[model samples]
Target: KLKLSLQEKKCSIEQKDRAISDLSMEIQLKLNEMIHIKTSLSGMSSAKTIIEAQLSAALSQITGKDQHITDINKELTDALTSIVDLKAKITTGEDLRKKLHNKVLELKGNIRVFCRVRPLLADEIVKNGDSDSILHLNILSENSIELLKGTANCDTSSMSGLKSRGNGAVEFTYDRVFGPKHTQADVFEEVSQLVQSALDGYNVCVFAYGQTGSGKTYTMEGVPDSLQDAGIIPRTVTHIFTEIERLKEHGWEYQIETSFLEIYNET
Candidate 1:
């Protein structure tokens, strides 16, 4: 009976020992899982810090761009204001220039005369039935004319402008004279300066006096759309309008007024 009781006790002690070993293994596995969870939390915290730093940098960059835009806008507005002031100054300067220019023109000549001789057309020769015109007019100088021959005999002493050279030929003097060889541009070169006098607030008078069909129309109104043959009226209009357009950039404005009247046959 004593030997049987000892064997049963040993078996019960062995079962208790195995149960303790299983409990120890289970606790170690639970510790390892806790360590893994802690490591995951640490990694998440580091990532949050990096994200916060990147966000701060992005916000700072956005603020810098906003300031730069503000500065540029202010500079643009100031530049525009300065341009306005400059335009006003230019307008004042233009007024002063007009006064000075008028004074200079007054000193030069209040009344000036210019003459342009016309070329003989082929139609005129056919109508007259002769290559030679009846009157022999010759240009002695830029401001002088010599009549080579004339049917009408006149006393030189009676005439104020005529000077007798020889053989009934007489020379006349004027302010300025252009020969048939002169082009339309040649005549306008002198006239363009005179046109400016009128713009400077002066009473200007320009007239043409010659026999019938002697180029009065051609000189005043050149061929249409022909730059080379542009007449005095067209050129003067162009000059004034171009000056007006140029002044507009400087804040100067102009109102154009035009009048036209032709006196024909003493009426």
Candidate 2:
């Protein structure tokens, strides 16, 4: 009976040992599984951190690019403004220069005299029929005329002796001179500036003086109704009205008065 009890105790001891070993293995397996889970979680956290850092860097770059674009836009706007200001200044400078030029012309005795030579009429050409007669008159420059006294009766007492000594040509100088070939339009071009002076607050008068058929009437009043054949008077009227319209932008208002007077024989 003692042997049997000892055997039973040993058996019990072995069974308890087997149970403890099994429980320890199960605990080790659970610990390994927990370790694996922890390692996986740490890796996932590191990946998340890297992704967040990349996202932050990308946002910063976008903000910086946006700011740079804004600065470029501002610079372009400023440049355009400067260009507009420069253009305004240039316009003002041009206007000032024109005003000063007109003032200088006014100070230099704007009452300038221009001489025009009348073309020979068909009747006169038939009467003279001499080509050399045309050569007697010489156009020296745009402002000078020379009348050659070639064995012809010429009134030279009033001349200033500016001619060549042997040629006996009386040289006459005026502010401007027009040749016989000059058209009505050509003459009005020079007279237009003088007409503008009247609009600029100046008393202006243009007169014609010569022999009966010396183109005085033609210069003052061309083919009456024709626009292309209009004279200085009509052209001056047109220009004055046009300038009045143009100067409205500069705050200029004008009143024009008309006067007609005939002073034949200095009456």
Candidate 3:
């Protein structure tokens, strides 16, 4: 009976030891699983930190690019404004050039003419009383003359080339035209530009040629006593000397030659 009891006690002790070993193995498995889970969580945290850093770097680069774009836009706007101003200035210059070219073209000619209509003679006023004057001649513009054709107004019959047209009025254009109202000074203003051409080394001639009693002498060799009626010849001589004096300050010198001639009956 004592031996059986001792054997039972020994069996019970072995079973309990085996059970404790099994429990220890299960605990070891659970611990390995926990370690694997912890390793995975650590890797995920490292990846999150790398992703956040990459996103931050990308945002910084975008900000710099946006600032650069803004600067370029401002520069482009300024360039456009400058281009507009340049175009406006160029247009103005071109217009001025065109006007100058047209003026030059108008002044170009070998035989330009200036027609000066003298005041009506005292005898003509007595004979016709201002009737023939208005009927015969009309100053159309500063540079145009209109001569009416044949009427019974025979007072202006001697002024040839004025009565050639047989019917309606004939309009004539000239480089310039002066009415009876214009003063000698007024005539000299336009003629002065021509005198300037001569100063620039150009050959120039100013003369008057017309029928008898047509005021040719009056226009060329005006009343010497009247300063206001002084003719082109005297004004030109004085202007030439005056200009010579003015130009002396610029180291210029001049010589002048003068000639006067009269031809009668095509001689």
Candidate 4:
């Protein structure tokens, strides 16, 4: 019986030792799971912080871009306004120039005189063997003429009756003088202002007075189809029509009348 009791005590001691070892293993496993959960939570927190920083930087950049766009819009508006004001000022300046030009014409007699020398014709050149004979007519200035000796068919007595110097050279003054080299375009420029005056409700008359074959017809009437060589009448008509079109923008309408009458030999 003593031996049997001793064996039973040993058996109980061994069972208790096995239970303690199993409990220790279970506790170690629970500790390892808790450590893994903590590491995961730490990584999540770091990611959240980085995301917040990026969001704030993005917002700041958006605000800066919006402000730059607003500034550009304001600058564009100002530029457009300045352009409008400059255009208005330019229009005023043009009107003032026209007024001043008209005033000058009124002061200097509405009927302006301009002299033009005709080029020597082919027949005249053949008749006068000396080409230098045509050079006897000297253009002293834009408003003066000097006819040297032997150029005009005037005697000394006849020249004295007129304004002639002792050298038998005659000098005449006029409002404007054009030499033989002046083109049809050049002559029309001087007459254009007068045509403009007529368009502005003023009566204007342009006449040609010279000997026969002195380029009067050529100056008054050039080739009808040629634009560069167009005379004063055609150029004036073209200018009037163009001005009418331009003035249409300013609420202007016009009705033009046409009339042509020629008197030959005063008949």
Q: Write the per-residue lDDT of candidate 3 for residues 1-53, one digit (tens) a residue.
A: 99999999999999999998998998899899899999999999999999999
Better candidate by TM-score, 3 or 4: 4
Error of 2 at 156 (Å): 10
**Model 1 per-residue lDDT tens digits across residues 1-267:** 888899888888888888888888888898898899899989989999999999999999999999999999999999999988888788788788888887776776777677677766886566555554535677878788876544433223434455556676777777789987788899998887778877666678787777668888789989999999999999999998998888678766778899988767773
For model 4, what is the C-alpha lDDT against the true structure? 0.79
lDDT of 2 by residue, 17-99 (tens): 99999999999999999999999999999999999999999999999999999999999999999988887786687578668
Candidate 4 wrong stretches, greater than 4 Å? 1-97, 130-133, 151-163
Whole-model lDDT, model 3: 0.78
The 0-to-1 C-alpha lDDT of every candidate, in the order given, reads 0.79, 0.81, 0.78, 0.79
> Each prediction's Cα RMSD?
6.6, 11.0, 17.7, 8.1
Query: Model 4 reaches what TM-score against the true structure?
Result: 0.60
Pick by lDDT: which candidate is best?
Answer: 2
| Cα shift from native, residue 22, model 1 (Å) | 18
Which ten-residue region of model 2 has the weakest summed lDDT? 151-160
Residue 60, model 4: lDDT of 94
Instruction: Indicate the TM-score of model 2.
Output: 0.58
How do the predictions measure up, each by TM-score? 0.65, 0.58, 0.54, 0.60
